[model samples]
Target: MDVRAAACRVEAPASRPLDGTVVRASGDSVAVRVAASRLRALGCAIRTGGAPLPPDAPAGLLRVERAPWISGGHALPECRIGWSGPVAVPMAGERDVQAACGIMHVHGRATGGPRALRVDYASVCAGVLAAQAVTAGMLALLRGGTAVRAATSVAQAAALALTQYVAVATTDPGSGSSRPEPGAERTPPFRSAGGVRFEIETFRAESWLRFWTGLGAERSAIAAGWPPFQQRFATATCTLPPGLQAVAAAWDYPAVRRAAQAAGVGIVAVSDAGTPLPPPPASPWRLRPLPTAQATEEAPAPDGRPRTGDGPLAGIRVVESANRVQGPLSGHVLGLLGADVVRLEPPGGDPMRGVPPMAGEVSARFLALNRGKGAVEADLKSRAGRETALRLAASSDVFLQNWAPGRAARFALDAADLVAVQPRLVYAYAGGWAEVLPAPQPMGTDYLVQAHTGVAALLSPPGRPPAPTLMTITDVLGALISAEGVVAGLLGAGRTGAGVRVETALADAGRLLRDTHEVGDRTADATAPVVSDLAAMAADPAYAALFETDGAAVYSRAPWTFTRPSDHRREEP
Candidate 1:
């Protein structure tokens, strides 16, 4: 209940060093103080800019503190942070909050979904990332007295929620378009005979095949494609209309559970019984310091974008050699905070580049994360490619990769190799699971992590099979976590001139969801309205602006703003 760790006593340092100023403006000084305390916990020697707080300042960074879910789950660090200045932004109020929610709402309307799902979808995801941002900023400060600022808008958070399927470009060339196929959006729930609900997921092609084989059902029982609701019937046969029939209705929960276990597929029961899921087992983030080898800090900067800007990570360089969502998204976050990121691809380019919904040769999803980044081509298997990659590593402050376990070292691209090239580099790695094994599994994926880590079990609604949360929730979370670790490493290197290795996995990200103790966990909100009329929301001028279209594509305004001195101009260095 005490999200601020108010009862925990943090001894102040005997003497404080003069650091940068933090300009904070929020009606809730308590929330501001909480954020300040987090920064101080990181050992930041910051002073609040001594200025008057603006009257109509938008939520700014402090909105993260006010997020309903922040105070729950894992407790905040214990140090008390102090500030001296007032903040600005004359045009912010409740309207801003509604406007932000409204923007995501409009996006949902464009995609077609229920209003309730729209309202909280972005907020929940944003809240998670917001909390991570605060923690990451603190981590950076703790590593060194770096003046790091994390500013994210509700809209940005909303956009992140959509990352799972947005422009889910298909690899199948015959599909003719990059848009996701119908029914690919969600894995539907099926009702059991006793009116209970449950769900199952197959992250890989082999999974559902195993499910059918385990049930001793004909292979034909499996759907031709990855439809979320193919198993709506309880009959062992696959010949049933989805969404109309309660397939599991023929079996009880235990029977269904047995069948899924026999198949070796992941499954969970749905509950509308209003029981909240348990909190995460451990803290969402774990930062461990690793031993470092002494070396000169003269690593050559990689050839890529000339980062010309000012922010927490200004002048920092990042080399990204990962693909799909997690690695690129982490690089994307670093870019947002003013890091110069260079994305490495093979001769043909990233596999994601070929996905459909293309503006040109690249997919929108690729553009979303890869924009503002420098790009290069390399063949990691080739001697020349390895040398090129090494050069890039030698010339960078950070290097991130999501290659399968042991694959990096095989390619001579692991942390040890890179650290040898750039000793002060912050090397980050993302993976599918946390545990290291002698042998690698087939592949780690977001869906599998959700099922394995009890995320599906917790999200299961009453009377329905267990279901996954948003597609790739753990994937995105893992990326954010990895990004935080990278920043922390960078700050640490800044202070001690020692390189560090940061690692995160999709499997570990599932723990963040578990750790999230919902705000006022309850079955019902007596004060809340039953439903919101989309039409009424669309009628408002401010809300309507959110739906504005630019030709065939719809455009949105940035949901949040940063007032950092370094944010003044974005130019190529």
Candidate 2:
């Protein structure tokens, strides 16, 4: 993907000037390169140096660095490196960090392999996050706040990527029963009689039953498979009975597809690695300015005083109505940045709140992302609920939602509607496909998006059927992209005094991941065996430090650390 082209396409034309130099220390890590490339695309003059910048450098200068571990206090013992088949080589400490964070465990469980080992993923995510932090710091300086320095580690990034897994593992110790033994082959990407490999997605039990029934699957087998199949998103493991696989294998690809279409199921043929992927979106997220009568105000220059307390978005307010991982995790990241987030839920609250593996009555999965956020109960289908939503948006700096494409417009609470009342708000929508794909869209869930965008093929082992890792890859990454969009929109709003609409989709996130990483045949050294016990690793002192538990619920610590000049003391002369 052309990083510069994507950046140029979404450039904040109406925002205040972002003129400055981004000084990057020389580093070979993919994370460092990604961050520098993105910063340069944002119009920051890039300067590479082997040494740290001089203390007397220009006030506009910002430094970016990538490290194996940001804590810099304790050194973790190097563990055995597992075989990284057909994936990018692991950088220094990459595999170790990922192992400690339980990423490999989740991947291995989902793929039915010893361990789906790779490091490129965490590094890429860290790079995007670093760029986000730099942008926020820049925004703070433009708002007359003190200059700030931000730092992140590959470990922290991996931890953030596995936040949901940590939540589930900590809350329910028995969840490990679903993990497949090493060398076990799981079913999902079932092979047809015609030698075609494909994946099917069905949301409701009826759809699952109908699809299997049309394919001549046994009633008992279909009924037994539904629980595990539906729970894969949360458990990261799906073990379907052999009868279901046999039923699929009996039919040819076209016949299987016909059955799926007749049953209202989503199906996609597994792509090959050599197949060319569709061009990625111009940008992962779209930002558009909203017309408002409010007059723009010139941004105040930096005052040189150190920014104190909280994060860059200390005083910002975000109102979010999101479900599942993508939307809630976006709001969670915003909260970590010190924004006050108020979650708008249905009158009885989000049903996800009752999902199993409870952490003191609240769902551990829900608590992972919505821990510190405030909640508001409103029946969005009702007029009073819409009024309440509008009232909240009128006073908030950002309004985020991930409802179906037309649900917001139907409720009269879309970007146009909210901006009419609060002209300076930043409205963000995190959807499944956006407007990129044709209509009659498949369900906009993570695994389906993976199959549609060829991500399933990219991660599959050589000669294996294409299968999406049940790790919620696109959901987590989409959330990160959405948060980045919200921050960018906020910056644009600050500069122009007008509302902005930020839109991103799961497909876009999948495309970004697919286009950025190049998959090849070079495999890593397989000297050490794969680690299997995630719970044991989580309890280890070195890994335990990365997470904190609250009432049996565990969550990752903040990924980035911010420091200002005031954090240090002046020497007495």
Candidate 3:
């Protein structure tokens, strides 16, 4: 699921809680922890022991003088809310309190399940706030008038709690209404999930606009005013490869576009969305589209010729945790195009660093890709390795990793965790899903996608064996598209303040590339055996996979012989 989109529904698996980032206890008396600073900020006083309490509650205390009994499908007596006291619980009495405490469904408890209650962040934050209240207030009253100030503080805290609790209860899951609990140590989602905590500094609306205006004006002046601030931005973009960007593009373009522009750079950074749209005509400056976090200079510069650089992307830094072919070479390409690319390898070094042709100097894969790059080794699964990855992710503008799904998460290198630390970071992923989504083939790969999507099939035939052209040209084509998406996302990030998540599967890319022909029409000519009557008749027989005469060649098929060969081949199967 998308990271940002998760706001409306922080979806997670039934087996795990907190989206696999954290877990929760399944016991009845779930333990909760609240922060002291946050409670004070909410205007509540510490009244008693920092007891573990549930979320979605308000001020007040009642001594439990009786044993528990069943009522309203529950085993606890109830207390319904009555008078609105400044320092009283919203739903008082033991009965109602017990019910609300357990079944309130405060944050759309149905969004998830037992896992929800377990790692459920609500119980934690709300519990913490309540703990502070009990301690501050109860302590003050029992400690005698010596702690009157604490009682007043508790009242103040209760007021804040009322507003916040009401906000939580009434606010729709989809609406991003209230900000995080004010003065929170970290954002709510982060606090709930216990991931990275980003320090935030607020900006007044007018002041924020002024900063952008000043920055835009400065950039416009720097460019010598050829393209106005708006004009340059209007065309600025980043290109992404087949990766995460593909998934992101499935969203509303306007929202994505707006999100990009807000990122402040000319491009947006997202996982590569494999689909490539035709680009706008070239101007003095070119815009790389998102999928690359913050658009990078894929093409050297606008100098009409590639120049050795000290320019923006000239020495920019990128840390790649990629492996084998696509992922590693992607970073290599960035370095060749002039960004500083650092390759993270396993203890044995990148597999590519030894892909045959070893001259003890240049490995085959490394020769073609890893030029002008450096390497380091780490076991991403270990604590030390993850720490290294974190350090690199924090410092780099782009993080490239090509592992199977769920692999990165185990290492905590998933999009959510990384973006929280650095929003400008562009993440790239390349994988294939034959089972998850429908595809022409049951197994997805460059060769299979091309073959099943008609690229290879078009070039091969029934009577003849399937064969792909040398050099994996089809894969390269998809890779190029993937690379472009990466750049586009980065550009979007440069323009917008938010980062994006993108994905491109081999199966999806191959099908997209083959969409040029009319689909679902039997008569439409789609290269080779699929061609229409006239085109098929005129096509080269042997060359086009049609039955041919005995000559050293007329490539066009003899329809008569072709029928027999095609049938015979099918019969043999």
Which model scores highest in lDDT? 2
Report every candidate's CA lDDT.
0.49, 0.69, 0.33
Q: For candidate 3, lDDT tens digit of each residue in 1-573?
A: 222222213222111111111111111211122222222222223233333422322332211111111011111111111111222334332222222222122222212211011111222222332323222222212112111111111212112212212222222223211122222211110110122111101113333233234323343322322221212111111111222222233444444334334533222111112323233213101222233233221212111223334212443466777653455545554553345678888888865554433424444234444545777788888999888887777766667766766788888888877876665666666555423243331323344344444444333334533332212323333343334334444433432434544454554444433432222222222121211121122232322332222221111111111001111111100
Candidate 2 lDDT trough over 10 residues, lowest sum: 73-82
Better of 1 and 3 by lDDT: 1
* Candidate 2 root-mean-square deviation in Å: 8.2
| lDDT string, candidate 2, 1-573, tens digits | 322222223324532223333344345455656666655644455566554423322111235332111122111110011122111322244454455456777887765544544326676677667777877765554344554566666667777888778788877777845456444348788889999888888878999999999988889989889998999888888888888888899999999999999998988777765565556544446676875525344322223223334888877788999998999999999999878889999988999999988999899889988999999999999999999898888778889999977899899998889988787788999998876467777678898788777788877767766788888888988898889888877766665556788888888777766756663212554333344665555565655545778867778877777667454322111
Best by TM-score: 2
Q: Positional deviation of 428 in candidate 3, in angstroms?
A: 1.4
Give the clashing pairs for model 2: none
lDDT of 1 at 227: 38
> How should the candidates be ordered by TM-score, best one leading?
2, 1, 3
lDDT of 1: 0.49
What does candidate 1's lDDT look like per residue over 1-573, in tens digits? 332232112222111111221223243322243334434433443245433443332322332121121222322221111111111111122223223333223222312432222122333344444434554443333322232344544345544444323322111222112123454333345566777655565545676666555544444535543332322110001222333233355567787777777665666554332344344323223333335546323323345556567444667788999987789888987887667889989997887665545645666556656767888999998989999898998888888999867789789887778877677777788887665212334356665566556666665545545555434556776786677667756654543445666777776666645544243222332232211233333233544333322222232222223343243221111
**What's each prediction's TM-score?**
0.63, 0.84, 0.36
